[model samples]
Target: MPIDPMLYETQFFGFTPQTCMLRIYIAFQDYLFEVMVAVEKVILKKAGALSAVQVRGSTEAFLRFMKQRFDRLFVKMERALLRLVLSVPPTVLLPEDRSHERHPQSREDFRLLQQDVERLQGRYKAELGARRALLAELEVQKAVRAQLRKTLRWLDGLGDAHGPPGLGEMMSLLIQHSGRLRSITEDVAQKSSGGGME
Candidate 1:
């Protein structure tokens, strides 16, 4: 079950959750003690608290423990925090950092990665250019086909109504096709010369 927002609003700190608590540890001779500080009391957050402690020691052995013990502990704590954060069906409590995720690499590895990336981009662009050129040619072919079909239909109508077309009719047909041919040639040439795809 999900916790109610209104219930949280009434029960927990106001809207912001910045207020926290800290627990400090002190060691003297052979004894150790802890102190807790409540920051929420001053900040208006009423429920829940956070705690962290700094260990200090007077004896040589205790001082060494204070200095040496926490390094591994800190590393473990950070790793645990990271795992907990990444595992959560993430919410505002955690922010994902995808940009800086890095793998161990040598200079040669990095150089090879760059080269591979550039090669891939080059191939992709070449394929893309070829695809665009093919599409343009297809469009040109379609227009030419449509023009040819119109001329063919006209010739078929003439043959159906009477017989095979004569000199005058053929001349008119050629004139019409010539205009369409010229347009088709211009379109092909423009595309070949790197003009805008039409």
Candidate 2:
């Protein structure tokens, strides 16, 4: 007896093809999380080695190693995700496939599938942008903190002859600067949360 493509499709892709596609998408997401966790462990281990480096050359070597590790991990992650996305049955489904046309609802189902793929892509791009912004903001905050500490140290060196500012005055200035920093932080957070593609 000959095999029927429609029967095979119904049996494997489910009555509603979209449901099967969503199941595959969710599975890929779960696999991505696992890969990320594994990469993070390796990154953390590299980060730990940084603290023990006393020499400048050793410190530079560790930094280079960390960067290389991250670069390789990112490349591997991209390839893996691309493979998973491409391997999805719906992604490979042909518009002219007669088996897919067995159900009159297939067109609408494919439209919905396209929309979901677009949404997921937009979300992934937005997340990547947000993370980059956050990292830049954190770097700025770290520099600002170092400068604040230096200023405080310099203030402490000023003797009473200069009638060093009262503790209250110093604290008031610090509070003003802190408020500005907090405002910038909040703005970044808000933009990241609301800047998703429509």
Candidate 3:
């Protein structure tokens, strides 16, 4: 049960202020050890003389005085209990999830991972540049092949006309050079294909 409204209760038969105070003291010692300190300060101070006067005085006056004392003690105890209940513990914290907590090891690992990624990016760029250079070389070889075909056609025309004294030797030399250029073009094409670039 909620204990706020539960003040000290005793039957009127053989009721006395000494009995009531003793009951309160015993209760304090049992359930509220520290609250007993407050009780001594609040209720039990000057209690001996107060109880003597109540014993000689009217029973109604004694009842009123005892009720006032109980009320004051209860109020103090309630405040102490409420402060205890409502107070936050020192270790308690908001945002208890620690999955993303950054320790030194994790941070170092992240830095190393970033470096590896950057190294891979640099290698990829270098490979791309090499591929572009190879493609340019292939284009140059194609142009050379086209030029050699035109020259062979011109040499054939010259042969039909039987022009010039060294014309056949020049034509033979041109054909041999054309064959070497074709072989070089095939080698470059094969190298480009064998390389891993797309």
Candidate 4:
């Protein structure tokens, strides 16, 4: 004898339909935390490697690697996060008890949830924008550092016999540019950490 589909559905999970949806949402949140940790490790590794390398070519390569990794991780993370959010059940308040009229509290709760969802979406977009801007700035810095290294190499080729020109002024300019880059990076970090961008 064939079993009924409803019997299997009811017996397998042993949860009401509404409860199951909530459970799924909770599970997705747990998985997101683990994925986030892995992505953080990747970023840290790339940053450390870029700092240690004095060679312009290697530094550029490291930065490129970081950009690629960030792009891939972000795509996956966004899809998963969006899916979890979209899965949340809509708030519905029905007057199940005939003795009592519909309560205003239900409408208020629904409005609050709607506001929360909008706020979360706004924060997610801001975070994504900040990440993209930071990546672009890092690319620009990489190009500047490569050009500086090339200029230094060319100067080295001009022997001590020629008595190369003083680079004190150039060094100062480079230091200023480096400082600007650091400031931009720190600002991005702060925005991301503070609740402005998730």
Candidate 5:
């Protein structure tokens, strides 16, 4: 059979033993304690009321007494219920999903979590940008080194054909610069290896 929503609604609090009698007893005891305290204060206000001869009250009289005190107690309970309803988390009222999202205790906690996520996203983006720049610089240095080697090869061919006087000096300078570029590229590759994509 389908569940009857009209007969049964959701309850936030759970009770031990889970019996209607226990629920009624707990409700009566809670209100009765407050009512008794209020009655004691009222009796205390009237001088000698406590010291007077205690009379056995009829059931009707006790019921009437409780009826009068319960009015204010009921209003107080209503206000408390309203506050409890308002303070309930929105997640509790919604249908459950299969996502791995954690439920925060309060709005402030949720806001702080959002801020932390945004901070992590920004940090990740910055690291990625730095890595990309390093890779680009490394690639540029490698291309420069290769071009230098190609030019030196062409110079060797010209030297074999009895080229100009300053050609030897130019080849030596180019070789030294090429060696320096190779060292710089090696250093850059080593530094990038930790966080490099390549």
Candidate 6:
């Protein structure tokens, strides 16, 4: 920003301050795109299916607005920068002008850009790790549910191959047990009554 456009034009042939500013603008645009991509991937990976769809829909709408706004800004900036570049007489860039590419402001901007990339990369890595854990937990739950279902089905299949016992079957079992118990109780009573023919 400190680089005066007129100063650069007089000093450098091809490289202009406006060109550097354009590149900075381009970097900002690229940064936004990168962030959007990372956000989309994280949302898709982290959210449930229904929530992900909803989130994606809303995010897409927001992204459309952002894209439109940035696109307009870019077009305007490009037009102005290009006009300035064209008005300036074309000159051959010197070796010194090449060093100007590392201008302090540009260097600081690029440094911040790099930091942003690194930060986003870290977020993506963490999201992927969390997703893996979530998937593993889901798999375990699915396996447990499958086992439970199988056990329930096996329990339901107990008794006979034809079908489970009905009320009639339960009543029959109860009657048979009661009949034996009754006979034993009567026998015991007869013995306690001295076992003589009564």
Candidate 6 local lDDT, residue 40: 84
How close is every model to the real structure, measured as TM-score?
Answer: 0.35, 0.31, 0.34, 0.31, 0.35, 0.31
**Residue-wise lDDT of candidate 1 within 26-100, one digit each (tens)?**
132123222112232322344334322211112334545755665556556544643453233332221223332
> For residues 1-198, could you state the per-residue lDDT of candidate 6 as single tens digits?
363456646455556666676687889878887888788888878876757678778778878899899888887877687566534554555676656655646778899999999999999999889777666666655565565566446545655564667889867855765675565555545444442221
Q: Model 1 off-target regions past 4 Å? A: 1-104, 162-198
Pick out the ten consecutive residues of candidate 2 with the lowest summed lDDT.
Answer: 3-12
Angstrom error of the Cα, residue 33, model 6: value is 62
Candidate 1 colliding pairs: none
TM-score of 2: 0.31
Q: Please provide, for model 2 over 22-47, each residue's C-alpha lDDT reduced to its tens digit, 9 standing for 90 to 100.
A: 46556765665566556555655767
Best by lDDT: 6
In the order shown, the candidates' Cα RMSDs to the true structure are 17.7, 32.1, 21.0, 35.5, 14.8, 31.9
Report clashes for each candidate as comma-separated counts.
Answer: 0, 0, 0, 0, 0, 1
> What is the model-wide C-alpha lDDT for candidate 6?
0.68
Q: Return the lDDT, model 4, position 190.
A: 53
lDDT of 3 by residue, 1-198 (tens): 554321121122234434444566667545543544455545435566566344444444644576578678876765564345433344543343233343335778899999999999999999889889877777766676676677668757865686553867777867877787677667657755654333
Over all chains combined, what TM-score does candidate 1 have? 0.35
Model 2 alpha-carbon drift over 4 Å, by segment: 1-105, 160-198
Candidate 3 matches the true fold with a TM-score of 0.34
lDDT of 4 at 80: 64
* lDDT (tens digit, per residue) of candidate 5 on 1-198: 752222111343332222433455568867776765666556656655444234223333675677667666755764465445423444553234224255435788789989999999999999889988878877766676676677667657755676554867777867867776677567656655645345
Candidate 2's displacement at residue 153, Å, is: 0.7
The alpha-carbon lDDT assigned to residue 84 of candidate 3 equals: 58
Candidate 4 residues 67-156, lDDT tens each?
577557655765565345423333422334323344345778889989999999999999889888777666666666666566556546
